[model samples]
Target: MVSKILIFMLWFLVWLLLSWPPRISSFITGALVSAFVSFMTMDILVKDRPSGRSPLRYLWFVYYIIIFLWECLKANIDVAWRVLHPKLPIRPATIKIRTDLKSDIGLTFLANSITLTPGTTTIDVDKQNGYIYIHVLFLKEGCPDHDMRLPVVSKFERILKKVFE
Candidate 1:
């Protein structure tokens, strides 16, 4: 099927990129692995194959990567500071936030992005309501009353809407 071929190409490209300077042996091995893996996982790995993404979506994806890296750096610094400070200024709490993205792929990317950050972990996703519960190592001083959506989450959700939704 077309999807299986696409998956094989994707997997082979990743193999070549990661195992750079692909020698004959590695190239042959990657082809075999890619073919086997793609065939085996085609049905379950991606339930919905989005059809014909706009060029703008690719641009948004690139922007999302930049934003994600910047947010990740900030989170790393904040976590490191908390660890080194004598007071360990941390008020860990779980808060619910809303996302606009509706597609399963979009939600998955958003949740994974949150979990990948240093200080936050996505606890649960309410798919029907577009709500995510996230555990944060440090909540804002008045977080219980204030908007619970962190800027990183908002940025990711926004860009992901353009990219995936």
Candidate 2:
């Protein structure tokens, strides 16, 4: 019951933020939609609610958002530089990397983080083996043993493991 309310509030907040300067009609419509969606999906959305009941996890999620935004900014700059330079430095390759995160939420977060980063996209995920195939725009040459755990994935995964797992 508490989880349902939280989900509804979160959905309403997102709708309000996205629809800034919310009018009375929009507010009522958003509230109704958010309530219906939250009530319907509360079970799946909050399946692991007990594990994430701690307030500390919410704080960590906020911190993760901050760090993720910074990383995204850096990635954008890097990609822009590569695009503007005369000599394109992008060495695109699809590499398979493994993750230790066990939960579906954790894996989804990690995959989304990878895709959100400017230079990388998650191609596919092998859930059974915990392997994610990612296509990267820039790959340094001769670094055959280069760490596949990109900063974005590693850092976000660490925080998400704490938050979800």
Candidate 3:
């Protein structure tokens, strides 16, 4: 029940922030619509409900996202430099990695994160078997290897663990 209320409030807040109201009526109408939509969709839409997250945990998640963005930016520059250089330093390979997370949402987040990164893209997810197939733009010696132990785990997985585990 509490989650439902939070979902509605969050949706309303997002709507209010994104929409500019020239008049009070529009503002009220938008908020009401957002609330109604969230209320109706909450049960059906939300797949994972992470338990026992403190306020500090959310801060950690934000910090991780910031760090990830910076890393991604650096990767983008490196990839672009390689692309424009005359050598055309390119090596493409596919990597398969196993994930310990046992939920659909976790796997989806991991796959999306790989795709969002500059040099990697998620090709397929075998959810039942808990594996991810990723295509990497640059792989030396035609071998794709990523250390998936701790910090090397996809950044989104870390947050999803906090949110869903």
**Largest lDDT belongs to which candidate?**
1
Q: Which stretches of candidate 2 lie over 4 Å from their true place?
A: 14-33, 48-53, 141-148
Q: Candidate 1 on 5-101: residue-level lDDT in tens?
A: 8889999999999899989998999999998999888878756657877879988898989888888888888889999999988888888987788
Estimate the TM-score of every prediction.
0.83, 0.80, 0.79
- What does the lDDT read for residue 105 in candidate 2? 78
What's the lDDT of the predicted structure labeled candidate 3?
Answer: 0.71
TM-score of 3: 0.79
Instruction: Score candidate 2 by TM-score against the native.
Output: 0.80
**Per-candidate total of colliding backbone pairs:** 0, 0, 1
Candidates sorted by TM-score, best first: 1, 2, 3
Name the weakest run of 10 consecutive residues (lDDT summed) in model 1: 140-149
CA displacement after TM-score superposition, residue 57 of candidate 1 (Å) = 1.1
Best by TM-score: 1
Q: What is the lDDT of residue 50 in candidate 3?
A: 60
Off by over 4 Å in 1: 1-3, 17-21, 50-52, 142-148
Candidate 3 — worst ten consecutive residues by lDDT sum?
142-151
With candidate 1 superimposed using the best TM-score fit, by how many Å does residue 62's alpha carbon deviate from the native? Answer: 1.3
At residue 9, candidate 1 shows an lDDT of 97
Give the per-residue lDDT of model 3 (tens digit) for 60-150.
Answer: 6676678668767877897889889998988877778777778775577666667766678888878787787778787655243355322
